[model samples]
Target chain A: MWSRRTLRQREELIAYLLVSPWVIGFLAFILGPMLTSLGLSFTETDLFTLEFIGFENYTKLLSFDATRTLFWTTLYNTAYYVFLSIPLTISVGFFIAILLNQNISAQPTYRVVYYLPAVIPGIAASLLWLWLFQPEFGLINWALSLFGIEGPRWLFDRKTAKMALVIMSVWGAGSNMLIFLAGLQGIPTELYEAATIDGAGIWRRFRNITIPMISPTLFFVVVTQIIWSSQVFTNVYVMTEGKGGPANATMMMVLYLYRVAFREYRMGYASAYAWIFFLILLVFTLILFRSSKAWVYYETEIGGQRS
Target chain B: MSGAAIGVGTARTSVKRARRTQVFLIHTLLIAGGIIVMIPLAWMLSTSLKPPHQITKFPPIWIPDPFVWSNYVRAVTIFPVSFLVFVRNSMYMSLMITLGTVLSNAIVAFAFARLSFRGSRVLFFIVLSTMMLPQQVTMIPLFILFSRIGWINSYNPLIVPHFFANAYFVFLLRQFYTTIPRELDDAARIDGCGVIGLFLRILLPLSKPALGITAIFAFTWSWNEFLGPLIYLSRMETYPLAIALSFLRAAHGVLWSELMVVSFIAMLPPVLLFFVAQKHYIQGIVITGVKG
Candidate 1:
C-alpha cells in the first residue's frame, strides 16, 4: 500500500517512529514541566488552589527582606560550598592522577583503592562521614590527637561544618581522578620525551606540554564539578538530618527548595526559586563554554583536522 | 682507560640509585594516600563488628574484640518489616528502571545515530541541551503532575520517566552506535533485515559494552536514588534502602554498630558490581569526559 513512497521517505517515517518515545518524553517530562514551573512561578498554588500573583515570588525572594526569606543566605552557602569543594576535589584528583600515571608497580590496584570511596552510595558515605566527623570519638579527631592537636567540633559547629563537608567531598575526588588519569594517559609520551630532549626540566615540561594537553579535560572536570557541587543535596541532607542546620550554615538552594515545596507546601515560591537557580546554572555553563576557546586545547585543531 | 671505566660504573650505579629512590617515594606517597582514603571503610567494618561497649572507646578500636557478627543479623531483624523488604523494593525499582532506560534510550539513540530523518540534528542538539536543565527546574511541577495523575506514593513517578529516555544515556549510546560501520547496516538491509532486526540482531550484540555501561549506570542511579523515593514512596514497606536507612537513623538514636551494618548491606550490591565491571565503569566515565 505504501510502495509508491520512496525508500528514503519510508525510512524517515520509521526513524520518526523509533524516536517518538524520546520526543513524547521530552515534551511530557522535561519541556512540559519546565513551562508549567515557569507559569507556576507567577501564581500561588497548593495543587488545589491557584491564585495569579504576578512576580510576587521573585520579588519577595529578591527583596531586601532576606533575613526572613533566606534567599541570599542559601545562595551564598551554595556558592561557598561549590567554590570551596570544586578546587579541592579537582586539585586532589589531579594530583592523584599525576602520581598514578608514573608507571608504578600495581597501578591498577592503587587506582582501585583511590577510586573505591567514590563507589560508595551517597547515603552510606554521608552516614559514615557523619560518624567520622563526630567531635570526640571519631577517627579524624583521634588522628589529630595523635599529632598533639585537639580537633575542632566538625559537623556540630557551624564554622567548621561546611569545611567538614568540603573535606568529605575530597575523599571521593577519586572519580574525578579517574577522569583526569584517563586524560593524562591520552597525552602522547613522545611529546614528553621530546620535551626532555629539548632540555625542559620537570616543571617546564609540565607547564608547556602537560597543562595544554589536558586543558580540555580540566575544562570538563571544572564544569561538571561546578554543576555537581552546586546541586549537592544527598550528603548534606543525610549528614545534617535534612535540616541544613548549625544555624542554616549548610542551607543550599536545592535543600531549601525541597523544604519550601514539600515541607512548607509553598510550591509556587519554590518554583520561582527553581527558575532562578536554573538561570544561574545556565549562565555559568554558558560562560564556561564561551571561555573554553581561550583555554581548552584541541590537538585535532593543531593537526588541521576538523573532527 | 681503567679510570674512565670506573667513572662510567659509578655514574650507572648513581642513576640506578636515583631510580630506586623515585620508585620508593612514589610507592610511599601512594600507600599513605591509600591508607588515609581507606580509613572510613576500615572504620565502618571495624565498628560494625565491635560490641556496643567498644564503639565509643577513645583512640577508637581498630579491631573489634569477640567480633560481634550478630550486628548484621540484628540490623536486618530490627526493622518493623523484614529489612529484605527494602532490598526487594530497591531491586525491583533498579531492575525496572535499568530495563526501561536501556531499551528506550538505545532505540532512540539508534534512530539519531543511524537514521537520516529531518530535524534529527536539531532534535539531538535539543536533547543534549536538556542535559543542562537540572531536575530542580521540573521537580515541583513533576510532583504536582504526579499528584494529579494519582501516581503519588507509587513507583510510576520514579520508574516511568526513564522509559522516555534521558539525555545522558541517549548521548552515550548514540556515540557508541555511530562507531559501527555503515557496511553492516547495508548488508543487513540487502538481506531484507528491517531496522528493528538490525538493532536486535546486529547492533545490540555488538554494543554490549555500551549497553552494559548504561545498564550499570541506570541500575546504580536507581539503587542510590534518595530524593525521588523520599518524595514518591511514603509507605514504610515501599521505602528503598536509602530512605529506610535514614529512617533508622532518625527514628532511633544512632545505633552505631547496627547502622554501619545496614549501611554496608545497602552499599554492597553496587560496590560488588563496581568491582566486577571496573573497566566498563571507567570506560563509561572516560567516554563521558572525552565526548562532552
Candidate 2:
C-alpha cells in the first residue's frame, strides 16, 4: 500500500498525463505559431523559402505602400459592419425575444423557425444570398418591383455590396436572440412585479429593469459581434471571390490577408497584416471590457465579474 | 374618490384595448420577419427547379412552370468522380472529429471539474486564451508542422487535432460536468469504482446533453470547414463537400440550377443535425453563460 503523499503525487502525475494532449496541442498548434507569426511580421521571408530579411515587412507595411488605402477601407467597412450589425441584431433579437418571451401561440415553433438560419452552413447561406441578390432574376428585386421601387445591382455594385453583407448578417441573428431570451428568463420575476406595482408601463419597465438586467449579456454579444465581424472573411470570400470588388467595396481586412498570404504567396507581409488586425481587435475588446463596468448590471455585484 | 375610480376604469379598459392591438402588431411583425427570412430559401428552391432560360428571367419566376427533379441528378453526374470521394472524405473526417472531440473534451473537462488536479485552473486559462488568437496567425506554421509530420494531404490533419480538447468545448463540458453533483462520483467511489470507472460510468451517462452539443458543433464545423481542407488537401479525392461544391461552381459557371441542387444536398446533414439536437444546443448556450 502506498503512502498518502505518494498516492497524491501519483494522482497528480496521472492528471498531468491526461491533460498533456491539450497542453501539447496548444503549444504546438496555437502558441508556437502565434509567437512565430509575431516574429515573422518583422522579417521578410517567404515562409517556404525561409530566407529572412529583418524588419523589412513591418517597415514596408507602415511607411511605403499605397496599400494603406486597402487597410483603412477594409477597417472602415469592418467597423461599419460591426457597428451597424451589432445594434440592429441585438435590438432585433431582443425585440423578438421580448415578443416570444410573452405568452404566445406556438412559441416553440416560432423559435425554431427563427433559429433555422443560424444552423445553415455559411457557404450555403452565402450561395443562397447570391441567388437572392441576383440583379435581374433575383427574388429581392422581384419583390422590390412589386412595390414599384427599383432594386440596386447588389453584388455587382460597389455601393450596395457591403450593405448586402450587413443584410445577410442579420439573417443569423437568432443565436443572439436565443441568448437574449435566456437572459430575459434569468431576470427575477419579482423585479417586474415590483415595477408593475409602482405604476410602471411596459416600455418604462423594460428600459429601467430589463435593459439594465441584461446589460452583461448585451456586452457579451457586442464584444463577440465585433470580433466576428472584423474577421468576416467567409461571406466576403464566397460573395466577392476575394476580389472585394466592384472596386474593392467589400474588401475586408481578413479577406485581403487571405489573398495576400495564400493567393499572392506573401506570407511574411500577411503575417504583419494579421498582427495589425489582432492589435485592433485586442484594443477594441479591451475598451469594451473596460467600459462594461459602467453599464453592465449583475444580479450579485461580485458574482458577475469575469476577466 | 368616485371620479378617480371612474377615470381608472376607463384607463384600464383603454389599456386592455391597447394591449390587444399591441399583440396583433407584434404577431404581424414576426410573421413578416419570418417571410423575409424564408424568401431566399424559397428563391433557391425555385431556381433549382426552373428551366435554363427561366433561371435568369426578369422579375424572377417565383414558381417553375415545369418542376424539374432532374437537376439533382444532373448535378451529381456532371461533377468529377472525385465529388463522391470528397463526400466520403467529409463524412469520415467529420465523424472522427466529432467522436474524438467528445471523448477528449469530456475527459479533460472531467479532470477540471471533478479531480483535484494541480495547475488545472492555470491550464484551463491557457486553453481559453488560445481561443482569442486569430486562426490566421497559426495557419502557415501549423501547415509547416503538419507537412513535417507527413500529415498534409491527409484527414489526420483535419481530424487529429480534435482528439485534444478544444477550449470552447472543454469549457462547455466542464461547466456541464460541474453541475453534476460530486456526490454521484463519491457514491460510485464508495461502491469501489476507480476514478476512470466513476467518470465513464457515472459522469459520462449524466453528461449526454453536453456530449450531444459538442458532437453537433464538431460535426457541423468539420462539415462546413473550407479553409483547413482547402489548405491541406490539394488532391481532389481528399476534398470535402464544401471544397468540392466550390470547384463545381468554378468549373460550371452559370449552371445555377445544378449548383443549387448541390448546395441543397450539402446543406442536409447540418440542418438535420440541428433539428435533432436543438435542445442540447440551446441548453449548451444557456449553461455556458451561467457557468462560464
lDDT by residue (B1-292, candidate 2, tens digit) is 1111111112233447768787688788888888877777777888888888888888666789899888878888886674577679889989999999998898888888888787788888887766666687787667667887898789888888889888888888988888888888788978978777888899999998789888888898888887788778878777888877777766875788987888888888988988887766667667665211
lDDT of 1 by residue, B110-226 (tens): 999988899999999999998777899999999998998999878899999999999999988998888789999999988988878998988989999999999998898889998
DockQ of 2: 0.33
Candidate 2 off by > 4 Å: A67-69, A302-307, B1-21, B289-292
True contacts kept of each: 0.65, 0.44
| C-alpha positional error of residue A280 in candidate 2 after TM-score superposition, expressed in Å | 1.3
Report the CA-based lDDT of candidate 1 relative to the real structure: 0.87
For candidate 1, the per-residue lDDT at A113 reads 87
Tell me the number of clashing residue pairs for each predicted model.
Answer: 0, 0
Clashing pairs in 1: none
Q: List runs of model 1 lying over 4 Å from the truth.
A: A1-5, A302-307, B1-16, B290-292
